[model samples]
Target: MSTVPRYIREYVDVNVDFDKDGRMLPKTLIWEDGHRYEIDRIKAIQPAPALKAGGQGDRYTIVIKGHERYLFFEHNADYGDEKIGKWFVERKVAP
Candidate 1:
């Protein structure tokens, strides 16, 4: 079996859209590497607002390291709260 690379990441809720079922649709999360991941894992949904309020809450923290940065979207809704609104993406610095 092969191993998977992980990285310590943080996600913040960006936006939410309600469907006919009144259930929340896919939420956008800003990853640590300054990328956005859209996922529909209800359980992974976190209250974005609370996190900004400085209140204690649960967030999906993982370790990822590889060339597949796009794969981060697979673990969407893995952190932050729904109220988080939008998360800031870090800017790249020149070496």
Candidate 2:
């Protein structure tokens, strides 16, 4: 039997760039350890579904160091009564 790699969701700091259309594009990933990884290439982008109540989000699939990684950003309305944004990176573990 073969094993599938599992991705662990972790919040990370990211620098994003927006085009003339105001679309968010990831540029670099800043690790808490102070190591920075340039995005290099973007494989896919998926917009998060909007909730009937409010808050919306976006997800980007990126390639870094020849590995597939996911960068996610979301806005939550009720966390602090004020809208707040969250950023995260989903990293995969080899099996």
Candidate 3:
């Protein structure tokens, strides 16, 4: 029998800094349980493709202060012409 990995993904609320080109960059992270973590440094910010065509928004991998875990952000397309996408976070775990 195989055991499932303990790491389950979670959606989180985040505060970030954006460039003039409107890129999503993480600055602060707030969990659903109300714990806040300020980003002391960004270890990496790689773009994950949302669609084959383009412009569906992006996904990012970031590391915050005091933790060696991988934090993710998914910025999705507009919901019903709202002119803004949604953001979500997921923590990665080693298998």
| Per-residue error (Å), model 3, residue 71 | 2.8
52 Cα displacement, candidate 1 (Å) = 12
Give candidate 2 regions above 4 Å deviation: 1-8, 48-56, 78-84, 91-95
CA lDDT, every prediction? Answer: 0.39, 0.73, 0.59
On a 0 to 100 scale, what is the lDDT of residue 40 in model 2?
85
RMSD of candidate 1 to true structure, Å:
11.0
Model 3 weakest lDDT span, ten residues long: 49-58
TM-scores for all predictions: 0.28, 0.65, 0.59
> Model 2 over residues 1-95: C-alpha lDDT tens digits?
87875655556788888899987788999987978999989998887632322334677778998988667778675776563576776556665
| Model 3 TM-score, all chains together | 0.59
Candidate 1 vs 2: which has more lDDT: 2
Candidates sorted on TM-score, descending:
2, 3, 1
Stretches of candidate 3 exceeding 4 Å from the true structure: 49-59, 91-95
Stretches of model 1 off by over 4 angstroms after superposition: 1-13, 44-95
Candidate 2: residue 55 lDDT (0-100): 33
Model 3 C-alpha lDDT versus the unseen true structure: 0.59
